[model samples]
Target chain A: MALNTQPNLFEPGKRYFRAFSPGDDFYEALIETHRDLSDEQSEMVNARLILLLANHIGDIAVLREAMSIARAGVVAKD
Target chain B: MLSTYQYPKFEYVRPPEIAEGRDGHYPVVIVGAGPVGLCTAIDLARQGRQVLLLDNDDTVSIGSRGVCYAKRTLEVLDRLGCGEEMVQKGVSWNVGRTFFREDEVFNFNLCPEPDHHRPGMINLQQYYLEDYLVQRARKLPNLEMRFRNNVIAVTPGEKQASLRVETPDGAYTLTTDWLVVADGARSPIRTMLGLDIEGKVFMDRFLIADVVMKADFPTERWFWFDPPFHPNQSVLLHRQADNVFRIDFQLGWQADPEQEKKPENVIPRIQAMIGDDREFELEWVSVYTFQCRRMNRFNHGRVLFVGDSAHQVSPFGARGANSGIQDADNLVWKLALVMDGKAPATLLDTYGDERGFAADENIMNSTRSTDFITPKSRTSRTFRNAVLGLAEHHPFARALVNSGRLSVPSFLVDSRLNTADDAVFAGNMVPGAPMDDAPIESVGGEPWLLQVLGDRFQLLHYVADAADLDAASVAALQSLAEGPIPVEPIVVAARGRAPAGLRTLIDAKGRIRERYDLQPGTTYLARPDQHVAARWRALDPARVRAAVARATCNA
Candidate 1:
C-alpha cells in the first residue's frame, strides 16, 4: 500500500502540461526503446512502457483519479 | 495494359453578332462555364431569367478534379435536371476505410439509415460533371453559352456591370444586370475588382495522379496515414467512372513539385503503391498547395462571386466543388426573384452571410485534417500518432481520427432568413436545415420527398385525417398561391388517406411521420432550395405568411 504522505499529491496518469525538461535525454531514451525494431515490436514496447510506468506508481486510487482527469479535455470547447 | 482516357474537344463557335460588333445586354451573365457557373445558368434560366455563360476554354476540365460529390450537392444538381445522369455514370460510395500504417483503424458508413434519394457521395471526374451540366444547359433555350469568349475587364456600376471580352473574332463589351464570377480560384474579375481575400496558406503540397486501370478494388473511399508503400506520407484513393482511379499523395513543402510531377518520378512511386502486377496508364498529373481563404463577401454590388472564386479550402474533405455547387443553388433563386422585382435586393445579401459562414466551417475542418495528416510540430505529431494508435482498439478514439471529415451539407442554423421556432422539434428538420427525404406514394408514381419539392417555396401542410384544418385556415393558405413569387401548397396525409384538391401525397411507410416528428395539422414552410424556413405544431396562416415573407427577405 502506498501512503499519501507529501503535502501535494502527484497524480499518476493526469495530463501535466510541459512535464519534460529542456534536456534531450528523456526524448532520446524514449526513442531508443524501439530502435531498429519492427512495427509490431515497437507497439509492444509502447504497451510495455505503459505497464512499467503504471506498476511503478502501483496505486489504484491515483490511477483512477488520473483517468477521470485525462478524459475531461478530449474535445475542445468553443 | 489500360488505355489512357481521351479528352473530347468542344467546338468553339463564333456568333455572327459578336463578330459584327453588336452590343448585347443580359439579365444575368455568368463568367466561367465550369460546374458552378453552368449550374447557376441552368437554374436561372429555368426560373425565366435570360442567362449568358462565357468561358475562355472550349473544353471540359482537363483533369479528374473534385471527384467526390456529397448528397446535398447531388440534390442541388437534381433540381438543375442532370442529377440522374451524374448518379448513373458516377461511382456512388457510402463506405470509407481509414488505415494507420499497415492496420485498418477506422471505417464508417455515411448513410446508416436507408430510403434516401442519393448516396452519401459519388466519385466522378470534374469534366464529367461539367459535361453533364453543359448538356443540360443547352436544353434550356433561355441560356446562351458563349465558349472561348474571355472576359478581360469588369466595371461594376449601380444598375448593372459592363464587361470587356476578348474573343477569337474581336473584343466586345456587354452589360449585365448581375455578373456571376465563377472563373475559378485565380479569378481575373476578382483581381480586377481588387477585393482582398484574406486567410492562411498551409505549408504543404500534394500530387494528384489520375490513372486508368482495370482493377477489381471495391468502390469505396480508402485513406492511409504512414502507408507501408509510401512510408511517412499520407495517401488517398477513390474510384471514378470509367475505371479511372484518383490518387493523391502528400508531398511535404520542401518537395520540388516540377521534378516530382515528371512521369519518370511519378511512375515509380505509383508502381510501389499499386503494385506492378496490374498494368496502368497515367492519364493526368498535377501538384497543388492548399490555402484556406475566402473573400470578404460573396456578393460585390452587381458582381457576385460563386464557387472557387469566392472561397477555397484544402481538397481533403471534397468541399471545394461540392460547396461551390451549393453556392449556386443558394444564389440562383434569390437572384431570379430580385431580378423580377419580386423581392428586395437585400435578399441577395443573405447569400454572402450564409455562405461565408459555411466557408469558415469548411476551412476550420480542412485545416484540422491538414494538421493531423501533416503535423508541423513535434507535439502535434505525437498527439496525432497517439490518437491513431488508440483508434485501432477503442471506438471512442476513432471519432478523433480525421483523415478528412468527409464533406456534409452545411446546416444554416444561424441564417437570418429562417423564422424562429416556437415549439420544440425532435428531428434534424429544424429551420434552415435541408428537408429529410421520405418515401411517398403519389398518383404519378412513388417518389421521394425531394422529387415533389422542385425549386419552389413549398408549404407542406400535414393533416391527420381528411377532416383537418378548418375552412378559415385553408383559405389563408390558398391565398399565398397568388403572389409575385407564388408558393405551392401540398397536403401530406398519414399512410392511408388522401385529400382531394391540394396535391396530396401519401406517406406510405410512415417514415415521414417518424422522421418529421409531426403530429396532426403540423405545417412546414420549405424554401426554394428545399431547406426548412419554419415549422409549427399547429396551423397558423398569419405565421405561415410571415415565414414566407421572411424567407424572401420581405418581412
Candidate 2:
C-alpha cells in the first residue's frame, strides 16, 4: 500500500467572516427546519440531512477521508 | 411494591488532646472517611503504616452517589480484604445497550469470558461500598478511624503538615509527617493550600433519582438518547441491589435545580421512564451539573490528594469514584515506601504522573461523551444525529455512537517507572500495563493470577525448566526476594512441569502463558500494585537491579 502523505486535509483553514455569503442563508434555513418541532424531530431532520449529503458525496474513500479530517484538528485540552 | 431508604447511625468519638500541649507527631493523617479515604487508610495500614483517618460526618455517604464500581476498582478492594463481600452483595452487570429514540442502536458486552472473579461493573449503593470499606478499616489495628473530627485548616510544609482539627468539644492542632486529602470534589484542604483545578465545566445538568420497586429489568445498563418519554434529553437506567434502580435524566443547562428535585416534579419523571403501573417509592433525588477538572499537581509538599480532591470528571463514564479508588491504589505503596525510607521522596511524584495521565484520559472521554449527548452547536448536533441514525443499520457507524464510553483501567504508557522493552516481545502485556488475571494452580489449589500477585513487588519468572536459568539470574532472583522490603518471586512453570525448588505455580490449562505471551524463560518484574515495572526475554541481574532502582526513584 502506498503511503498517502497529503498535508493533513483536516487542518483548520483561516476563518473568513462573511456577511452576504450563501452559507449564512443555509444556516438560517437549517434552524428554520426545527422551528416548532420537538427536539427528537429536529434530530431526525438532522439525521436525514446528513444522509442526503452523504449520498451526494457517494464514494466510501471520500467519506472516510472526510470523517478523519473532521476528527483530526483539535488536540484534547489536557 | 415500594421500600423506604434507611440510614446508618455511627457513634461520635472524642479525639485525644495531642494538639493541646503534647509533642506528638503522627506518621500519616488522612482527611475524609469516604470510600477513597478509608481505602487509602486500609492499604497503608496493611503495609504496616499507622494511619489516622478523620471524617467530619458520622455516617457513610448520604445517598446512592456512585453505584457503578468497575472491575479494576473491585480488584483493588479485594486486595484490601473486602472483595468477597462486595462481589457477593453487589449486582453484577456485563451488558450495556444504547438506544436512539425507541430503537436500540448498539450494545456492548464488557466481559464475556468467565474465569475472572469480579464482573465488569457492579451496581451497589455508595453507602454499601463505604460500609464495606469502613468495616474493613476497623479491623486493621494500625488504622484509627475518628468520627465527627473535621479538618478546618491545613498548612503544608517541606517535611510535615500542620493540621487544625475541629470537633464538637473544641479545636486542636497537630502535626503529621504526611497528609492525605480525599475530601470529595469541594475539598477544603485543597482550597486552603491554594491549589487550582483547571478544565471545562460542561453546561449540562442531570437529575439522579433512586427508586425502590420489585421490577424484572435484567441486570444491565440501559441508556437512551432522546427517548420518546424524555423528548430531547438523554436518560440512563441501572438496577441496583435490594430492588432499587438508579435513573438519571439529562436536564439542559437552564433547568431549575431546586424545582426539579422536588418530589412532586421528580415522581412524574420516574413514572414516565418506568411506567406508573410499576409501584415504586422515591428513595433519594439529587440534581448536579457536570464538571471535568483536576488539580495541576496531586502531590503538594507533604500533602497528597486522592479521589475527587485530585480530579473530577463527568458521571457519564463512571470515572469519578472508580478512578478515585485507583488513585488510592496507586498512592498507598509508594507513600508507604517513602515513609519507611526504603524509597526516596521522588517515588511519591510518580503517583501524580501516572494518575494524572489517567485523569486526562477520563476527562477526554467524559468530555466527548457529554458533547455527543448534549451537542453545543448546530454542526455538532448534525454530525451526532448522523452517527446515531447510521448506527442503527451499519456496523461501521455503531462505534460512533457514544453513550458514555464505559470506564476501563488506564494504561500508563509514558510512566517513568517503566523500563522500556529493548528485546523482541509478543502479546499486549507491556511494561506499564496492569497484569492481566488468569487461573493458575499452586501447591494449595487453583488461585487466580491477581489473587497470588497480592500487594507486593513480584518477580514473575516464566520458565519451562529450572535448568535453563543461569546461576547469576537465579542469584538475582534470590537477592530480590531476600531484600528488606522483599519482592516475592513466583516461578510459573509450563503446563504440568514442576520446578522442584523455589515457589512454583503451575500454568495449568496454559491460560497464563497465552495471556502474558510468555516465552520459555521470560521474566517480568511487577510493582506492588501489580503493574508491570519491567520485563525481558532473558534475565540480566544488572538490568533488573537498575529497573528496581528506577522504579523506587532511587536513581
For every candidate, the chain B TM-score is: 0.97, 0.96
Model 2 CAPRI rating: incorrect
Task: Provide chain B's TM-score, model 1.
Answer: 0.97
Q: Can you list each candidate's DockQ?
A: 0.04, 0.04
Error of 1 at B249 (Å): 0.9
Question: Candidate 2 on B1-555: residue-level lDDT in tens?
Answer: 234445677787767674355534699999999989999999999888888999999999988899999989888998898988888889999999999889999888878766676789998999999988888988999899888889998878888999998889887787999999999999998888889998888888899999988888899999999999899899999999888899999999899999999999999888887887998898888999978999999998799999999899999889999999999999998998888888988888999999999999888777767877887766667766776776665554565667776788887868999999888777667888877788778876748788877577888888876545556656767777765567777778764433335677877668778878888778888888978899888766567778888788976
- Tens-digit lDDT track for model 1 on B318-431? 999988998998998888889889899999999998889889878877876787788765545665777677676665556667788678777788899999899987877889
Docking class of 1: incorrect
Please list the residue runs of candidate 1 whose C-alpha ends up more than 4 Å from where it truly belongs after superposition: A1-78, B1-4, B466-473, B496-500
Q: TM-scores of all models?
A: 0.88, 0.87
Regions of candidate 2 where Cα sits further than 4 Å from its true position: A1-78, B1-5, B18-23, B465-476, B496-501
CA RMSD, predictions in order: 8.6, 8.3
